[model samples]
Target: MIRPDIRTDWTMEEARAIHALPFADLMHRAQTLHRAHFDPNTIETASLLSIKTGGCPEDCGYCSQSAFHDTGVKATKLMETEEVLAAAQRAKASGAQRFCMGAAWRSPKDRDMDKLCDMVRGVSDLGLETCMTLGMLSPEQVARLKAAGLDFYNHNIDTSPD
Candidate 1:
């Protein structure tokens, strides 16, 4: 069994050993580790709602939504509060434990921020946990979202510090 907290970079010798292992053997080992850490009967599920789509100013190479890419995805305005609430209810009915709202933009605008707070309240009313990934947010914006009952915020550090 692999150590749960080990983060050492494996040398080529270790890499070769792992490669020599059978696929099913590796899967079984991973399954055993996961079951040890979490309940076997626990159903883990999450759903994403694209509240705002496309039109970002960043030049992130991997993202199609970046201003540098011509991925043909049109920039869209933020969805209405009622629309977002309906989606959240559907996610809950589909057995999702959490509903994540994602917006494609550099940072949320004033109107987007207001809509986000309303969305959070709507999601909370459905008894599902709420999370947001709305790009880089100011401390004040963070506090505002928290006040609206947002459970978590995801800020992606897209690349290494180097």
Candidate 2:
């Protein structure tokens, strides 16, 4: 049964109070909530593949793929549609319910949007939910992605960061 106290929004003070709780206490609270709302015995898996690896111009300290960092990751062009589909196949075979494509970019260039959309379509055709995290996107770009039937568009609060 759904909890009667469930809410769609929380006040700042309520959020802060949760954040201020002791680590163990907070974890316990979260676990209790999860147990109440989710089936504890069920687990789902996802696979994240870097569709475009490295060469990001932004220098976010937390990222290893940034051009500013010497993480020894060489920049590469975007993976081909076939390559991405193969990875999605592997993921599905390994029991992943969703396939997430990630790119190390400040934002995908207009020239790259077509290829990105093709990748999303190919992955979705494989019977897996398609997701992408290609930095920032313009309104037009988002429309193209939506037209291609993208299931999710994951973005970070900080550009080019996790």
Candidate 3:
């Protein structure tokens, strides 16, 4: 059986040994752990909406939304609060337990924070979990989001420090 204790330090050899375990044994262990912590038959549904698309300043090569890439995606201004709320309502009606909003900005502008907060509150009021991926956010912004009832925030980190 896999160890139950949480661990932060693991040697490369130890990790390699675990990776070398028999496929069937690995699957059994994984399934057992999953069933222990969660309902095996239950599924959580989520919907993702791009509230603001394209025109990102960052030159992340892998991202199609970056202005530096010619990915054929046109830049659009931020959506109106009413429109966002309407989308959230639709998401809830379609049986999504979680609604996620994404923007193409490297980071949201201070002025736009108010609008974002409004969107979060609106979505949360619909009894659906709210999440956002608005790139990097300052501490104050995070605090404001928490106050607005945001459930999760997603920020992707580069694989290498290039």
List the candidate 3 regions with Cα displacement exceeding 4 Å: 1-6, 10-31
TM-scores, in order shown?
Answer: 0.75, 0.86, 0.84
Candidate 1 per-residue lDDT, tens place, 77-101, comes to: 8899999999999999999989999
Error of 3 at 74 (Å): 0.6
Model 3: pairs clashing at backbone N, Cα or C within 3 Å:
none
Question: Which scores better on TM-score, 2 or 3?
Answer: 2
Off by over 4 Å in 2: 1-9, 159-162
- Sort by TM-score, best first: 2, 3, 1
Q: Report the C-alpha lDDT of model 3 over 52-111, residue by residue, as the tens digit.
A: 999999998888899999999999999998999899899889999999999999899999
Can you rank all candidates by lDDT, best first? 3, 2, 1
Candidate 3 Cα lDDT to native: 0.94
lDDT minimum window of 10 residues, candidate 2: 153-162
- TM-score for candidate 3: 0.84
lDDT of 2 by residue, 22-115 (tens): 9999889888989998997887689999988999998899898899989999899999999999999999999999999999999999999889
Model 1, global lDDT: 0.89
